[model samples]
Target: MRFPCPDLDPPYYAVIFTSRRTPGDGGYDAMGERMEALAREQPGYLGIESVRAADGHGITVSYWRDLESIRAWRQHEEHRAAQARGRADWYEAYEVRVCRVEREHGFDRQRA
Candidate 1:
């Protein structure tokens, strides 16, 4: 099970991936897990939060230390393979946005 990511400091970068799945699991679960694990190992990776609805809509936001780190993740060999598979199999439609976070504030009951 996935939980909300811990609040991170501001001035970081966030890559938001919004997607609509094609249909069925189609091995998406395994690939998605692998990608998340690989991302955690990359330099400058901070955290990630993801969720999907029963209707196959989903969003995943990955936090990074800087633009360079984001770019490196985009070009990662394994990530590229996953992207290709996503285009060919997993996602029916998707959009990506990269933004610099200038401020952040949140409350977590567990943390408090």
Candidate 2:
């Protein structure tokens, strides 16, 4: 899915990952796709957005059903390994923010 954000209010968790990517590597693309696929298979994974900028900085925000789900994702072995690779190879710098989304709203237009 391109985006996975929802328009509901019942308390959800958001994992905001901001990163500056390293130069010349295909590893990040593979790992990112793997993570997205893996996340969909995990319970409580609502959705995610992987956004990048022209200067190599980007943000990936993933929504979850609860804090427990976020924690489980954090402790996932494959995720941990990917995190390590991110630090060692893919990312020049990165920061993660975990927050509670108490409210949300959005709209979409469809052409007939």
Question: Quick one: best lDDT, which candidate?
Answer: 1
Worst 10 residues of 2 by lDDT: 1-10
**How accurate locally is residue 62 in candidate 1, as Cα lDDT from 0 to 100?**
94
**Model 2, span 6-108: residue lDDT tens:** 4546588889999999987668788889999999889989888877887899989998999889999999999999999988888889999999988776667
- Candidate 1, residue 11: the lDDT equals 95
lDDT of candidate model 1 versus the reference: 0.93
TM-score of each: 0.94, 0.89
Encode model 1's per-residue lDDT on 1-112: one tens digit a residue.
Answer: 3657776888999999999999888899999999999999999999999989999999999999999999999999999999999999999999999999999887877679
Q: Specify the poorest-scoring 10-residue window by lDDT in model 1.
A: 1-10
- Candidate 2 at 33: error in angstroms? 0.5
lDDT score of model 2? 0.86
**Candidate RMSDs in order:** 1.1, 2.2
Off by more than 4 A, model 2: 4-9
